[model samples]
Target: MAANSPEGATPRESRSWTLRLRRAIDQHLPMGHLLPDRQPYYVGSWVYVFGVITIAALAWVIVSGVVLSFMGPQWWHDSRLGRFVNSLHFWSVQLFFIFMVLHLWGQYFMAGWRHGRAATWMIGVVIFAVSILTAFTGYLTQQNFDAQFIAINAKDAMNSAGIGAFFNVLNFGQMYGLHVMLLPIGITFLVVAHIVMVRARGVVKPIDAEGARS
Candidate 1:
C-alpha cells in the first residue's frame, strides 16, 4: 500500500484538467438544470416566451446581415436577391426590438430584480442599451438618403455629448466599421454574458397580485 493510502482503501482519483473542467460545469450548470425536462408550472405564461422569441429574431438578423455584407451595399440596393436578404435583416431588427421591449416591460412589472437577481436585470438593461447602439450604427451603414439624414442629425447630438469628433456619425467608414465589427462584438459579449447569468440564476418567479393591489 502507498504511504498516502490506508489498508484496504481505494485510491482517490487525481484532479486532471478535464476533470476540473467537468467539475466546474457541474457546479455552475448541472446537466439536469441546464436542459431540464420540466419546469415549474408558473413558467407556462405566454410572456415568458418573448425573451426566447427575441433571441430567435436576433439570430435571423445576424444571419441575414452576414449575407447582406457578403453581397455589399450596392448589391443589396440594386439586386433582387440582395434586396430580399436586406428586407429580412430589416424585419428581423424590428422584431428583435419589439420583443425585447416587451420582455423588458414584462420583467419590470414582475419586479424581476428581486431575490438577488439584480445583476441579471442589470445585465438585461445593458443588453438593451447596447442593442440600440448597434441598430443605430446599422442605420448609419445604409448608404442612402435616410442614412445621410440620420448621420447629419445624429452628429450634433454626438458633438453635444463630446464624442462626435471621434465617433464621427457622418463618416460612413467609421459607422460601417462599428456596425459590422465593434458594436456587434460588444452586443455579442453582452448577450452571451446575460444568458449565462440568466441560466445561473434561473428565471424570476411571479409576484402576488394581491400584494400589488394592497
Candidate 2:
C-alpha cells in the first residue's frame, strides 16, 4: 500500500485545497509575524502603547455593555448594581475614545500609512467613524428626555441629509438594535482587520530614522 501510494506523502499532503490555504496564509501572515516575540526598537516608545490601551478599554466596554444589555435600560436606571455596570460601560467607552484618539494622532504624526500600510491606517479611520455612529445610536436608545432631545435633533440632521426615510433616529427599536448589535460587530471586525494588517506589514519605521537611512 505504501509503495502504491506516493512516497513520503502524508494524508494531509494529499488535500490540495488545505495545502493551498496553508501556503497562502504562510505567505501572507506567517506565524512569526502575526505573533512576534520581538519588535523594532522604535516600538518601545510610549506612543506604541496607546493602541494596546485602546484595545484594553474596548474590552472593558464590551464586557460592561454585555451586562447592561442583559439587564435592560430600566434595571440600569433603577438597580444599584445595574447602575454601576452602566457607569463601567460609559467610562470604558470614554477611555476607549481617549486612548484611540491618542493612538490615532500618534500614528498620524509618525506617518503610519508609510511602508505600504495605508490599508491599516484606513481601517483604523473606519473604526473611528463606525464607533462614533455606534455611540450616537447608543445615546438615542437611552429612553429618556435626553434621548428624546438627541433623537429630535438627529432626525432633523438625517432629514437634511435625505436619509431620514431609511434611518429614523426617533425609532427606539432600530437605534437600540444598531447600538447593541450591528455597529459593535462592524467596529470589532474592522479593529481585527487593522491589527492583522499591522502585524502583516510590521510597524512603520520612525520618520527621522527613515530619513537618515535614505
Candidate 3:
C-alpha cells in the first residue's frame, strides 16, 4: 500500500479525476444551495415570477419548433395541423420575448446584478441578444414572399456592416440551421447557467422602501 493512499484504497481510486471534479462541483455548487427548500421572503413578489414564466414560454417554443422541423416546411405551410403547430411555435416565441422583457426590466429596477451577480445579469443580456438573432433567422426561414423581402433587406444591412460574407441572410439552409439548432442550444445553455448562478447566489432582496422614495 502506498503511504498517500487511504486504507484499502486502490491507487487509481485515490487519484481519480472524477473524484476531483465532484469535489470541485460540491465546493462551488453544493446541493443545498442548488435546491434550497426556501428562498428569500422577497421572492414571494409577483415580479419574481416573470422569469419563470419566460422559461416556460421558451419550453413551448422549443417543443413546437422541434415538431415543425420534423414535419418539414411543406406540411407546416399547407396542412391544417401543421399550421396549428407552427402557430403555436410563433406565439410561444412572442410570449417568450414578452415575459423575458418583463423579467429583464424587473431585474434592472431591482438591481439584480448587486452582490456578485453581475455575471448572471450579463449572461441574461447575452441570451436576449442571441434570441433576437434566432428570431430573425426564423423569419428568414419562413419560405414565403415575406421571408424574401426581409432577407433582401437584411442582406443589405449585413453587407453594410461587412458581415454578409459570413452571415448571408438569403441562405435558407444557413438560416434554418441556425434557427433550429445552434441558437436554441446557445440560449438553453445560457439559461441553464443563469438559473444555476441564481440558485447559487440566491434571489436579490427587495429595495428598501425608504431607498425607493429617495
Q: Which prediction has the highest lDDT against the true structure?
A: 3
The per-candidate count of clashes, in order, stands at 0, 0, 0
- Cα lDDT tens digits, model 3, 1-214, are 0122234446676587676556556655799989889885657779889999999999999999999999876688889899899999999999999999999999999999976789999999999999999999999999999899999988988999998999999999989988899999999999999998898778866654333322
The alpha-carbon RMSD values of the candidates against the true structure, listed in the order shown, are: 7.3, 6.5, 6.5
Off by over 4 Å in 1: 1-22, 208-214
Residue lDDT tens for model 1, 89-204: 99999999999999999888879887668888898999999899999999998989999999999999999999997999988888888888788788778888777767765776
Top-scoring candidate (TM-score): 2
In model 2, what is the error at residue 89, expressed in angstroms? 0.7
Give the better candidate number (1 or 2) by lDDT. Answer: 2
* TM-score of each model, in listed order: 0.85, 0.88, 0.87
Candidate 2 segments exceeding 4 Å error: 1-17, 208-214
Off by over 4 Å in 3: 1-17, 208-214
Clashing pairs in 3: none
Model 2 weakest 10-residue run by lDDT? 1-10
